[model samples]
Structures are given as C-alpha cells and as structure tokens.
Target chain A: MLNVKDVKKDFPVLKNRDVVYLDNAATTLTPDSVIQSLKNYYQNLGTSVHRGIYQLANETTEKYERARKKVADFVGSDSPREIVFTKNCTEGINIIAYSLHHWPEMEGKILVTEMDHHSNILPWRFMANGSEKFQLEYVDVTKEGRLDLEDYKSKLSPDTVAVGVPGISNVVGTVNPIKEMTDLAHERDALVVMDGAQWLPHRKFDISEYKVDFLTFSAHKMLGPTGLGVLYGKEDLLCRMPPPFGGGEMVLKVDRRKVKWNDPPQKFEPGTPPIAQIIAFGASVDYLNELGISEVNEHVDRLAQRAVNKLSEIPYVDIYGPKEGESRGGLVSFNVEGVHPHDLATALDSLDNIAIRAGLHCAQPLHEVMELNSSARASFYVYNAPEDVDRFIDAIKEAKKILGGADER
Target chain B: MKDKPEIYNQDVVHHYQNPHNKGKLSDPDFSVTEENPKCGDRVTLQIKLDGAEISEVKFHGHGCVLSIGAASILTQMIQGLNVREALELTFDDLVENMGNPAKMRKDCASLSLNALKKALSGW
Candidate 1:
C-alpha cells in the first residue's frame, strides 16, 4: 500500500490549505524537491545552455543536458537525442502536423479518434483543411466512451499516414489500449502519435515496449514545472521531419544564401529553452521514481474505483465513463440531475474548496457524442487521497439541493 | 441554506429555477440560437413581433444558472420593448439587470442577449 500521508508532505500546497485539488488532468501540484531544484538552478547558476564555456555555464549546460537524459530514461527511450523540448503537449502535436508536409511517405488520411483532446484534433483539422491531398477522418467512440475498434479498423487504409490517439480520454477517463492500437497502425504502415499528457502521469510509461512512433506529454501534468513539454520520436522519423521553428541553435551554419539545419533534437529546439523548468523536471522524475510509478498508478486507480462506485450508488448521479469493473484511468466525469456542471463546481468550491474541472474539457466532440453540454470532472494524482473523493460526493449532493435537483429521470 | 456567492444570488437562482417565457413561440417573426462554445451553454430565442413593437419574446435552451437566469431576465426585459429597443439592450445592461457576474462567465450571462440581438437583426 502507498503511504498517502507521506506522499502529501512533498507537495506544499496540500499542506497549507483545505484544498482538495482534483484537477490533475489540468496540472499537478509541484513537489518541494522540484521547487527546490528550480530555486537552486536560478539562485546558484542561471545561464543558457550551449552559449558559454565559463565554469558556471558549463555546469548549467551539464544540468540541462542531464535533464534531457533523465527524461529520456524516464520514458524508456534509448537516446536523449530523440527527445525534443517544447512548450506543451499541444506544441508537440503541432510540430508533427506542421512537419508532415515534408514527408512524402505520409500521403494518406490522418485517422484520429473522437475521444482526442482539442490539442490532438485541431492541428490535424488545420493540416487537412489547408492541404488538398491530406484527408482527415475520425474514429467513432462507443456508448461506453471507449473508442470503437471496428470504427478504427474501417478508417485505417493504405492511404493512412498517421493515427493520432490519446492514451486516455481526459473527459471520459477511458484507458485506451494504446499498444494494440499502435501495433494495428504499424501493421498498416501508419505511424502512431500518442497524446500522453493525460495518461502518462498516472501510469508506468515504457515507449520501448509500447513502440509508439511519437509520444507527447506536458511536464506540468506530471508534478514537474510548467512551460515545459516533451516530444519523443523515433530516431529515423525525427531525422526526416522538418524542424517546426528556425533560429540560432537550430542551425549548423546560416548564411544570406545558404543554411544547414542542425541535428535531429537540436534542429527541433530553436531558441533559448525553459532551462529552469527543465532542470526542475529532472528532480520531479527523481521524486516520482522514488515513489515508484506502479504504486502511483495503483493508488490513483483505487481512488477512481472508490469514487465511481460510491458516486454511482447515489440515485441522481450519472457517471460517464467505463462501466464498473472495466479498466479506467483515475478520473470521474459526472452530472447530477438538475445542477449545471459549472454551477455545481462553484457550489463545491464555495463549501469545501474542492477544485475540479467543469466544462467541455477540450474534448468537445466527445461531449457532443455523449449529448452533454458540459460535465463536472474530478481527476486524481499521486497526492490525492480517497478522502477527497468522499468530500466531492458530499459536496455534489449539496449542489443538487441548491440547484433545485436534476430532472427526476 | 448556505449563503449564495455574489455570482449566484437569490435572484439569479430564482430566475434559473423559474425562468420567464421559457418555451419557444409557435410561430415567430424572428428566432436564433447563440452558444458559448467554451462552456457549451446555448439558448434559442424566438420573438413574435407586432411591426415596430414587440408582442412576445421567449427563450428555450439549457445552460448554467447565469445563462438561464440571463435568458429568463432578458425575455422579461424585451417582452414589451420594440425591435430597435431590444437590439439596444447591451451586454452591460444584462449584467446590471442581474447582479454582476464573474468576468469568465460574462458570456454565459449574455448568451440570450446575443441571440435576441441576432434575432432582432434578422427582423
């Protein structure tokens, strides 16, 4: 069993208030170790990497590159050179979409699922709309909010260039079988792009075993600092794709008439990176490693299992996600009989300081498929405990009374 | 009952629960639907006009308390007003009519007004 109380102490925000933050899908609370790492980076040796040869600059460069290696190790990638630093997961998706025009092998349809976040969908939508050759299609979601495998097969054809899928749906919390999906796409000679932003933090990720062509995740969602993202691509594919941006460090040599772009990872990173955040992210990887990803995954699953089971017992509560006994990532999106999701979130915030997400959750198409305008979502991370879910349920009952209850159905 | 937040006062709650003219007109001169894409709140406003004067106005849709209350309050405000007068009802007027709402929710409180404005333009 994971020690919840001991784990809570690492996060200063959890210690200071009565805040039961259940919005981990948006961002996780940074731990003290990660914060300390950031302060140490700025207070001791604050300098841009690859810019100087002074003693402090050398140390800074070493730490920054070490952070890259740490992130690469954390994700089971053989080489740090395959990892490209970005602003967030959204930018990572954009990088692939923008660079796709340069690859002639990817001449077919871009098959994405309806369950993908707007970050995953909009870039492809823009790419498809801008180009006459690229055709974009969606894999339908099942009634249970799982991706319809049959629909995915139907969309997969010889012309399919890439299949963009979420490791888990942020709204519905469906834990997709990404390895199987990746294998299926690979059989069709289509690349797979996994939006790991929502799913990576909750489980043990091994890209080596999963063999996904590209995986993108935000550092902020995984107890690391904000303004930092990781895009892991296969060495061969990355070498072929065009750099999304052009600037100083990204080029081997630049002249008025001719220029040569730098190597794979460096080519992708153009400007001064988020050095402090990247250094701090290395500490977060250490922190999570100490706790063990399997333990974190189990702890979160237990909370979600308890939350879903208990919330379902309430007559008025309608939980939207996988059925009980099915595997789901740790999150519960639901609606009470009459209270609006926003109003319910506010009501909970008023009483218990229980923060949650209440909106389209950037999966508008999935919400439309579910016929919900909006729904309240409670997501958990390693810091969250079962007690938080209990308070959430009680607060929801209180919300129903104040909002005049949902229709009796 | 717990004291409501300023954004969810008794007036807003009452209007949300018991919205005014909440069903669509059978046959109307103008109708339109406005949606807040971020929150997925939507309202379709139907108006039955009498030439330059407005004979009836009703709204039917689903949204948060702020939006539903705004729609309810808007129908009451524009029922007797002319088409030009209804169009003149600005976003600020709706905020003033109801208690001030949070900055993030301004669109929620103005959904019906936007629909009403669009409907009046078609008229």
Candidate 2:
C-alpha cells in the first residue's frame, strides 16, 4: 500500500498550502523529483538537442533521447522511435488527423465516442469538413454512462476507417475496454486511436498487448511538466503517414522543389521541442515506477469510490457513471439538487480551500446525452487521503446550506 | 480575497428567488438569448420597443445566484431607459448595485448584460 503521508510530502504545494486538491484529472501536482529534473536540465546545461558535435550539445542530446526511451519503456512501446513529442494531446490527435490522409484507409467513415473529450473530437471534426475525406459518426453512450458496445458494433461497418476512443471518460469516470473496442474495429479494418490522457496517469498500458494503431496523452496530466505530449504510433503506420508540421531539422534533404523527410519519429516532431519538459517527464516516469502503477491506480479508485459513497448518502445529490464498488476511474462526477455546480465549486473553495473541477469538463456531448448542462467533478491521485474525501463531502453539504437549501428549487 | 457570503446577501437571494420581468413578451420587437458557454448559464431578454424608448422588458433563464440575480437587476434597470442607455449598461454597474460580488464571477454578473447588448445591437 502507498503511504499518503510520504506521498503528500513529495508534493510542494501540498506541503505549503492549506488546501485539498481533488482536480487530478485535469492535472496532477508535480513531485519534487520531477521539478528537480527540470531545474537540473536548465541549471546544468541549456542547449539545443540533436546532432551538434560539441561536448555539451552531445550530452544534452543523449539525455533527450534517454528521456524518450524512458517514456517508451513506461508505456510498453517496442521502440523509442515510435514516440513523437507534440504540444499536448490535442496536437497529437491533430497530427494524425492531418497526416493520415496519405493512407488509403483515410477515405471512409470516422467513429468517435460521445464520452471522448473535445480534444479527441475536434481534430477529427476539423479534418472531416465536408464528407469529402471522411464522415464522422458517434458511438452512443448508454444511460448509465458506459460506451454502448452494440452501437459501436453497428457503426463499425467496412466503411469505417478510423476509430478515436478514450481509455477513460474524464467526466463520467467510465474505464473503456479499449482492447475489446480495438479488436472489434480491427475486424472492420479500421485504425484505432486511443486518447490516453486519463488512462496513462492511473494505469499501466502495454501497447503491444492492446494493439492500438496510435495513442496520445499529455505529460501535464501526470506528475510531469506541461508543453509536452506523447504520440505513439506503430512503426509501420508512422512511416507511412506524412508530417503535418515542417521546420528546421525535420527533413534529411530539402530543396526548392523536393524534400526528403526524416524517419518516423523525427518526421512528425518538427521544429524546436520542449526539451526540459520531456526530460523532467522521465523523472515522473521513474517516480511512478517506484510507486507501482497498479497501487496508484487502486488508491485513486478507492478514493473515488469513497467519495461516491459519501455523496450518495446526501439525498439531494445525483452522481454520474457507475455506482460504488463498480469499475470506474479516479473521478466522481455529481450535481446538487438546487445548487448549481459552479456555485458548489465556489462554495467548496470558500469553505475549505478545496479545489474541484466544475462545468462541462470538456465532454459536452456526454453532458448533452445525459440531459445536463454541466456537472461537478472531484478527482484523486496518490497524494490525496481519505480525510480529503471526508472534507470534500462535508464541504459539499455545507455548500448546499450556504448556497440555499435543497428545496429552494 | 472576497467575502463570498457578502455576494449572496439577502438582496441577491431575494432577486434570485423572485426575479422581476422574468417572462417572454408574446409580441416583442426584438429578443436575444445569450449563454455562458463555459458554464451553460443562459439569459434570454425580450424587449418591446416604443420607437427609441424601451417600452417593456422581460427575461427568463436558468442560472446561479449571480447570473439570475443580475438578470433580474438588469431587467429592472432597463425598463424605461432609452435603447442607447440600455446598450450602455455595464457589469460594473451591476456589481455596484448587487452590494459587490467577486471580480472572478464578472462573467456571471455580465451574462444578462451581454444579452441586453446583443438584443439591441441593431439600434
């Protein structure tokens, strides 16, 4: 079992601030080790990566590539060459949406779930502009907030070319069975894209085991720094796709009329990347490896379950997604009867300095399907404790009183 | 740094509970609905114009204390003001009238003002 006290000490904000942060799904608090790695990179050596024959340049480049290998290993990828660094998960999705037209499979229907974040949906929406390239279809979400597998099957016709799915719903906390979903998509000869922004932080992923064509996740969502995202594609698929971005050092040879792009990973990552952020991400991977992902996953799930049970006792509150003791991720989404979620969030902040996410949580289509305008979400991570859940629940009850009673509506 | 309780004082609660001019005009000159897309709070303002003078105003929507209260306050303020004067109503004026809310919730205080401005944009 992970020690919450020891884990809390590693987070500087937790040590310094009088707050209970339950917004880990948006971004996790950075550990000191990760911060130290970033400081070490800038303090010791600040130089451009890649081939520069000088000693410092070569050293920095080695560390940069080493970070890539560490991330590749953490995600169970076969080779670091499959990983391409981008701005964030959104940019990674865009890179594939823009580049995958090079393949013959690009000209068909695109399937995406209603539970996916806007980051996964908008890029494909922008790409499939007029149905000339691909027409977009949505796999329905059941009333209980799980992905409708029957709907997914009906949509998985031979015309389906790409399927973008999330490993976990940010709003609903439903852990999608991507392996099963991917296998079904594969049977139809469609490429599967997994948005792992929520899953990568909480669970251990083996790319070879799941066999997704591509995966994207944000470093900031984990204990790592921002301005860096990982896009992992199969070696063969990445080489076949073109790079949507172009700049210095992306090409082996470029003249006025012709350009010979670099290999798979290099071809996708054009221009100067976030060198320090990626290096610090290696430290984050090391921190997680030491703690063990399964333990972290279990700890987070327990907190979510605890929160659900506590909130369910209140007659006025209604929760989304699975019930207590069911399979869900680290977040609990809910709404109070008379109090708006925004008001609840503000009241919680004022009462106990608690931080929780409110609003659409970037899954508006899911909200529409559920017939809700917005909802409040409380997410947990390694540093959070059971006391945090008690405070969160007590604060919500107090917030209801302060905002006005449940019968006000 | 704000006393959040002060933002939801008796006046705000009263207006939120018993909002004035919160209905649709059966035959209105111009009507506009504005939404805070981030939070899904909406405000719809209906107006019946008597030439350049504001004849009647009504609003209805679902919102929190700040939004619904501000909408009620705004409808009461613009009942007889000219089109130009109604268009010139600001969020600061709402904040001043509501005792004082957090500057962070200026969007909440301004949702109805945004609707009023959009309703009279042609004028």
Candidate 3:
C-alpha cells in the first residue's frame, strides 16, 4: 500500500532522466527533508556543542540531544542514553570490539556467522589476536542463505562471550532471526550483537521487544547523510562497558593524572561529533516514520519478489538466497552465465543506466562459503516500484543481447 | 566520441562475444592468473616468446565486457612486442583503447594489463 510516486518525489536525484538506481543496499539517496535539515544546521546554528555557554552552542547541543532521542525512539529503546553515535557501522563494531577487550569478565570464544560483513568479522579477529584465552568460531549458512541452526547449536558453549550476527545480509538479503538467535545464545550465557545496517531502513524493528544486547547501523543506508552511525546498547550493559575513545566532551572531569569518563552514551562519543549529519539522520527517521515501516517493508518485498521472478525467466541467470518472499529482504543477488558480475553490472549500466552492485559486498567469508568470487546485486527500497523491476529486467535482457547472448558461451 | 556508448560498444562487445587469442599457450615462457575478486573478474595470460620477439600470446578467463575486451585487445596488442613492451601497457592505455571507459570501469578494463605484468614478473 505504499505510494512510490509520492516517495519518489521526496528524492530529487530520482528526477535524473537517465538514471535508474537499484543500488539501495550500498547507500540510499537522501530525502529532501534530511537534506534541508542538514542545510539548515550549517546555515543557521553552526557551532561547537557542550563547550560554549552562548545561545548558539546551547541550541546546537539541545538539537543534537533531540536527534539522539529520535533515533532511540525509532528503534523502540526507552531512553536516549542507550544510543551512542559513531562515524559509521564499522566504527560502531570497533567500539564494541575495544570495549570487550577491556571487560574484566571477557573470556573464551566469540560466536559469529560466516555470513557476517567484514565490518562484523575483522574487528573481532583483530581483538582476538595473541589472546590464547579467546577463540572465534563461525556458524555456517546453508546454500539457500538460511542460517543452519544445527551448526549454530553445535558452536554454542559455556565460554562464548557474545554472538555477532547480521540482521539482514548485504549480498544475499537473507534476514536472520535475531530474536531466535539471541535467545539461543543467551541460553549459553553469551551476549548478542545484531548488525542492523541492512535491516533498519527497510523494515520495522523494536529493540525493546527483541531485547538484543546491542545493535548497530549506519545512517547513510537509511536515507540520511554519510559519516554518521548508531549503536544501541542496553542501558545497564552500556554503563558498564568502557568507552573505546577518550577525549573532549566524553569526560566529566580531567585531573593532571587521571580522568573520569561520563556515563553511557556520552562516554562512547569522543572528539567533535558529526553534528550536521546527526541532525539530518533525525529528519530521515521522521520521514520513514511518516511512511510506516510495515508499508515500506511490504513495498520492498514486492519489488524483490518481482525482480527475482522476472530475472529467473532469463536463461543463464543464477540467483542466490531464499526463494520465498517472507524469508528474504529487498535484495536479489545473482550471476549471469558467461559474464562476470562486473561485466554484467557494467553492461546493464551502459544499456539502461541501471545501477546495481557487483562484488563480494564486504562479506568475503560469505562468498568463500558459497564458492563465488563475486555477485551482481539489485536491492530495493520504498521509492522502487514494480515498473523499476520491469525496467531492471529489461535492462538485463538487453545486456545479454548486447553481450552476444548467453548462448555465446 | 561523446555519442559513443559509455563502456560497451560494438568492438568491445564483439571481443567479449568472440575473444581472439583465447585459451592457454602450452609450454609457454610465461603464464599467470590475475583476479579482482571484488567483482569476480579472473584472467589467465599465456605468452610464448621467440628469443625476445613475441611468438604467440593468448588469454583465457571469465570477466565483464571491459575485462574481456581488454584481454582480447591485449592479446592482439602484444603479439610481436617484447616482454618489456608488454609490461608497459598501463590501465590508461587499456581505457584509451576502449574509447576512454568510465572511471568506475577502469579496474575491470585493467585486469588484462595487470595479468600481463604479473606474467612478466615471473619471467
């Protein structure tokens, strides 16, 4: 029941006559409201916060705090104190990585999935290095892109500190059952961190209801400005975890020798934050809230299903991940026969200005597990419609013809 | 030139469709495989030499139009050149040969050039 026409109007980039963007999974186009909010921030109240006692700094600080509350409310967290701002999702993961390294009770193994993005995988690997006490194990995924629960169950042990899993895959668009996976990990006395980078913009997710220990996502993926990310941790756990960085604005008092870090959200934010981007992120959340998340999910699901069906009809195209609409998200990954993913993407772009992602999508382990070096991915969002799918399919067919057909192989 | 296709043209498409000098040159003086892995582009280069004068050059692999075209063109370009001359082929030359491809497609088009350099490195 989502109106693509109305949604398309919100993004000025859609007006480009030749461009048909299908690379939403990489990053979405910012809405007009978010862009306006960003412009307003710089034009009107551009000042350093928490330092000056002037009216401009005070107003900026209040607006920044308000943006934090908006992000917390969007994810169904009770208080804004739980939301910590970072550079991007990669920094958010690193924050947790550094915090776990400092934990007194940190011991044993960390459970992760082979399907995790490099952002989720490398930080833990870097933290576990030279520590004989810590081990890292990955849960294997099935060929259909579903997590093998049996494999996950076998890896769960008493010494597991946390299980980091992606809510939705960047490459395959497989939606993991975070609640179920977290519940299983909890039974084994392990904390859970959900990488919601691909999940937050497309679907409705309630952090309170899910009761996940921590969740992280980049704002740029959700139609906001770049260089901003969100990390939502339970208040109690966040208060106990040490801050990854220490500098101005994060400390309550600084002595000659020692310094006392501020409480939960503020401690994690070090140095000058990306104030304008955060303000724009708040506008993006407001825009998404207006278009209900459920409706957005429904729209994306329809587009993805339509794309999968139409692309399947083309001979020599092999799709990855779940076939059922409910099991997958708004993305479809595939490789065309007799063509490299880069070639297919390039051909498609030339023929019809259709932009699709082609690569390992920063999930090298997932590709290694699937035995594929790269894949062509087309992901959808609220602005995408059935007509977009038709055009995308037509572009692919044209690419095949221009590349001398699949029969040429 | 502005009216030409962005990165796909008749010549590039034809090379991708029916690439010349494809497949390995058995018992050749030099051979190598280069891959981008990000875009799943793979290329294997095989070169045969007759006392510093190129005797035969061939390539076999899987990749996109730019990559395939570059490999096909590379085989044709390096046929009579010495190993040092073959090593001089840069990404710019590859893009120039394809009517100056988009900046994004440069990596794909340069695969064959990189493979030739890799093959020469072993020699």
Best by DockQ: 3
Q: Once model 3 is optimally superposed onto the true structure by TM-score, how far is the C-alpha of residue A359 displaced, in angstroms?
A: 1.9
Between the candidate structures 1 and 3, which one is better when assessed by lDDT? 1
Per-residue lDDT of A361-389 in model 1, one digit per residue for the tens?
Answer: 98899998888889999999898888888
Query: Each model's TM-score, in the order given?
Result: 0.94, 0.97, 0.94
Give fnat of each prediction, in order.
Answer: 0.48, 0.36, 0.64
| Residue A372 lDDT (model 1) | 84
TM-score of 3: 0.94
Predicted model with the maximum TM-score: 2
Instruction: Return the top candidate by lDDT.
Output: 2
iRMS of each prediction in angstroms? 3.9, 3.9, 4.3
Which residue pairs in candidate 2 collide? none
Q: Which residue pairs collide in model 1, if any? A: A108-A159, A337-A406, A338-A406
Write candidate 2's Cα lDDT for A30-112 as tens digits.
99999999999999979889968899988889999999999999889869999999999989999988887555657988999
